[model samples]
Target: FCFKILNFPAEHIMHMAIGTSLSIILVTVTNSMYAHHLNKNIDWNISKKMFFAIVIGALAGGFVSKDLAAKTLEIIFSVYVTLVSIKMLMDVKVERDPKATKDVFYWTVGFIIGFKSTILGIGGGTISIPFLTWRGLPMKKAVGISASLGIPIAMAGVASYIYNGMKISNLPEYSMGYIYLPALVGVVLTSSFFARIGAKLSHNLDQQKLKKAFAIFLMLIALKIFIG
Candidate 1:
């Protein structure tokens, strides 16, 4: 939104990357910590396969993004997000997998999720949770693992954005590589407060409804981007 639709000034794409990474990092840490405190199973063995592949993909994505034209990137991201939104909006039933996924499959999915997360400047939860659940893990456990995966994805993306923007000329003021300080500060402040509220609300809410609402929201954003 910032870069493509809202027309934020130079380095807005990088700013979005860093800002999103920082915000998701905070949320991921908090959620994963709370889930861990509850003795939830995080599937560390699976996470190991995912983390290794995802981190590399995240870095590669960030670097690859640096070379794309702004319009091209915007179209690609908008289209991808739109398709994901549409998929989430549908009420598709997936059979739970009782068996563990193959190592190659985990690595492949992890890399794709990680790369897309960086390219989209969003966390992998939306993609990973569904994938994990489809692979036969319970929803809660899948969410936990996805949250944990955010750490490496965000870290790699931030580093890559920083590296990509390090020597770019004409970036906005108060910038650290691709990270715009003001944007990061603002998002961090709101994310800290809202994360707690969201956590609390989840316990009381109909998650299916919430998911539908979120899908609608994403659809609107996608429409705006495509129209722009």
Candidate 2:
């Protein structure tokens, strides 16, 4: 929404992003449940570990983001999203029944991902999937776990953006804090169904093929954001 769909300023766009994130919970939940029932590979334990850290990080990021320069935030966002592209391009092997690294390691990763995700108004999958894979999770399970953890990021972003945006008196119409009602409604109506399809495809396809596709997709997004 930089220069393409909308022309809102960075901070305001972040609020819009947080609002859009609210619908992602549906997609993530659907993804997790399907993965658990059909694939039997959902990592609820690691998801639990990441939840607390993400909430705290997202809450803090809302405030910290206001102090950051837009250009700086853009650079940070571009750099991290691109990590997924690079990691996937490398074709890293997926570990079977891999044990999660350590609590401290995940906690650290969770916080950083949460902070950046909130500030950038992202869903966190780009960071979450890559991190999970880096620590040995198979691609399918990594996608499920990443989707599971998206709930906390969305919840925290919604609350944070709502709270932070309340103090500003100059926001546009049909607005609650920073979230635009029209966009939220539109996203909520459609994102879940597509997300479910995406989850299903992730399971049915060859992971190597998935990696190549996902890598290219992320690269395009990073370039788009960076160019804007």
Number of the predicted model whose lDDT against the real structure is largest: 1
Off by over 4 Å in 2: 2-11, 22-38, 94-100
Please give the lDDT score at residue 219 for candidate 1: 83
Q: What TM-score does each of the candidates earn? A: 0.86, 0.82
* lDDT tens digits by residue: candidate 1, 37-154: 3555477878888989998888888888777766676677678778888887895756665776789999999899878877878888888988888888876577668867888888
Q: Which candidate number maximizes TM-score?
A: 1
Which lDDT values do the candidates have, in the order given? Answer: 0.73, 0.72
lDDT of 1 at 17: 51
Q: Write the per-residue lDDT of candidate 2 for residues 151-207, one digit (tens) a residue.
A: 788778777777777887766677788677777667656765666676677667887
Q: Which residue ranges in model 1 land beyond 4 Å of their true spot?
A: 1-41, 94-97
Question: What CA RMSD would you report for each candidate?
Answer: 2.7, 3.0
> For model 2, what is the alpha-carbon lDDT of residue 35?
52
Specify the poorest-scoring 10-residue window by lDDT in model 1: 10-19
